[model samples]
Target: MLVLAIFVGAGAFIWPQLHGYAVTGAAYGARVACSCRFVGGRALGDCRKDFEPGMDLITLTEDTAARSVTARFPLIARQTATYRDGWGCVLETWRN
Candidate 1:
């Protein structure tokens, strides 16, 4: 029926959104992050790759005046889990 088709279509569109919300909610309880590969000496490129679409990422170095090797990363996961074999590890998030 046409009504059934419309219902299915609506469900399809909401499915991804519902899944994303659940994942992001779960990620909010995260205490640690899995480190990824680094391209340059500085920059959070590794962490960025692990980021989900629609997710906001902010990384800051330990010291602004001093040249350091440490960074603090804050990520907001928007998508759900994505597993890539070659990428090494799997990330639990929603695509931002």
Candidate 2:
């Protein structure tokens, strides 16, 4: 019971920050990939190289019709950024 309580306490304290990290990371990734693919005129496929070397869990998807990119970290968080023709990338949502 003591161990379980300790685990629960730790989880409660840690989970929110963990989620925050994932959300921030995904948002940054989305913005970077969007800029690379749209403003920089780089191929969408090549934007995978923009992610940090160890961050294989993050995934990036592109929507040609919307001119946007989305980055997701499984169940934790996801963020999308859209590219305007002359303005570069802007986040679709204010929060991740």
Off by over 4 Å in 2: 1-4
Model 1 agreement with the true structure over 15-59: per-residue lDDT tens digits: 778666645543431211222332223343444555555544433
Give per-residue CA lDDT, model 2, range 1-96, as digits (tens). Answer: 999999999999999998998888898889999999988889987988887876678889999899999999899889999998677899877563
- List clashing residue pairs in candidate 2: none
Q: Please state every model's RMSD to the true fold in angstroms.
A: 11.0, 1.8
Candidate 1 structure, TM-score to reference: 0.29
Model 1 global lDDT (CA atoms, 0 to 1): 0.39
